[model samples]
Target: MNIAIGCDDAAVEFKNILKDYLVSLGYEYTDYSEAPKHSSNLYADVAERVARAVASNKHERGLIVCGTGIGVSIMANKVPGIRAALCHDVFSAVRARKSNGAQIITMGSRVIGPELAKTVLKSWLDADQIDESSLPKVQRIMELEDAIQLG
Candidate 1:
């Protein structure tokens, strides 16, 4: 699957780990790592870039990371058409997509280790693998993304 990944300085270590994992899995991904590890990095801004790329319909999903994941998720969600969720556990990641149809997942560098982070990714990817066949619930929830109360 084509994935979009982004991270700030605080998430660099974890991001590097995920990068190799993604490579080994032969998953083609686009990364928005600010400053190239030379200068300072801004989590919120990088998250926004990742969200925007996903919103453009180029990639199927996105993964964002930062110190605590909260701030990055907030910033990514602020962008229209991007439903970014901060998932600290497997269940959260599942529900994020199953219930809300979130297209982006966020993780905390301080909260999860590389192994668990991989599990979270795998869980979400598993959800993506599930056939939508007659899943009205998923369709209805996903349709909410198109809803606009233009008063």
Candidate 2:
């Protein structure tokens, strides 16, 4: 699957690592954050770009990274129809896709090591099918987004 990936200055290393991992796994990815390694671009901006790419179906999924992951996750989720999950562990990564049908996964560079991050990313990527029982809940989430947008 094609993946949209981005990161702020704080997570450039993590992004590079993940990009190599994606290649090793035979997945294609587009880098949304092309700024210099230590550029001042805001994490929210990168997150929005990646989130929009996925929301528009330009990419199948998105991966965003920030200092704490929280900032990017919050910003990405602000976009309509986007479910961005901040996942630091394997279980959360899997559930983000299977239970919430999240199209975007955010990682914290400061909180997770490279090996653990790879494991989390792999788990998320492998969780391609959403559980049938969670369909209604996922639908409810989309409905809520619509409700808020129409308000």
The candidate maximizing lDDT is: 2
Name the lDDT of candidate 1.
Answer: 0.82
After TM-score superposition, the amount by which residue 49's alpha carbon in candidate 1 deviates from its true location, in angstroms, is: 0.4
In angstroms, how far off is 73's CA in candidate 2? 0.2
TM-score, per-candidate, Cα-based:
0.82, 0.95
Best by TM-score: 2
Q: Least lDDT summed over 10 consecutive residues: which range in candidate 2?
A: 33-42
> lDDT per residue, candidate 2, 66-138, as tens digits?
8999999999999898999999999999999999999999999999999999999999999998999999999
What's the true lDDT of residue 119 in model 2? Answer: 96
